[model samples]
Target: MKILTIVPAHNEESTLDSCINGIRNQTIETDILVVCDNCTDNTEQLAKSLEVNTLKTINNVHKKSGALNQALDKYLLDYDLILVQDADTIIDNRLLENAVKEINKDTKLGAVCSKAGIKDIMSSK
Candidate 1:
C-alpha cells in the first residue's frame, strides 16, 4: 500500500523543516510531497534539500483547499492513500501506521481528526 502526504505551505520556512522531518522519521516509508503556494521564502529550497517531491504555484485561490486540490490533481493518481496536511503541522511517527492498521481491521472509518494546536493561544489572552 502506497501512501502520500500532501503538505500545503505558504511562507512556512521556519516550521516546514520540522514538519517534513517528522514525516521522514516515521517507521513506515511513505512518499512526501510539499506544495508551495505563493511562497516568498525558501520553503521550496528546503523541500528540495529533503529530496521530497514539490509542487509550486504562484496564484493563490482557496488558501489551503486550493493548494491541496492542485496537489490532488497532479499526484493523487500515484498514491493509494492521500493525507492532506498543513505546512506547519507536525504529526506523530506512528500516526500513519496506526491509521492503516485500524482501517484494515474495520474498513469503516470515514475520517479521523488528529490533535492540533495553535501557537501561543494561551498567551494571546
Candidate 2:
C-alpha cells in the first residue's frame, strides 16, 4: 500500500528534524511531506535539507487544519493512506509497521492512532 505521511509545521525549527528523522526511520517506509505553514523560521529549509517533500502554505489563516487541507487536497487521491503527524513529535520506529498490520487485519478499520508521550528533555540535559 502506498502511504504518505504529512507533517504540518510552523516555526518548529527545534523539533522538526527529530520528527522527520523518526518518520524516515520507521520500519515501514512512507513518503514524508512537510507542510510549511506560513513559517518565518528555518522549517522549510530544514525539511529540504532532510531531503523530504515540502509544501508551503500561501496565506493560510486556518492554522494547522488549513495546512493539512492544502496538502490533503493535493495528495488525498494519490496514496492509499495518509498519516497526519505532528511536527513536534518523534514517533516510534515501529508505529507505521504496526499500524499497517492492524489496518490490514481488519477491513473495517477506519483509522489508527498512537498514544502520545512526553520525552524527558530535562533529564537529558
lDDT of 2: 0.92
38-97 per-residue lDDT for model 2 (tens digits) = 999999999999999999998889999999999999999999988899999989899998
**TM-scores of all models?**
0.85, 0.94
lDDT for each residue of candidate 1 in 15-121, tens digit (9 for 90 to 100):
88888888988777889999999888999999999899999975767888888888888887888777778877778888888777766776677556666655642
Return the lDDT, model 2, position 21: 89
Candidate 1 TM-score versus the reference: 0.85
Pairs of residues at least 3 apart in sequence or in different chains that clash in candidate 2: none
RMSD of 2: 1.2
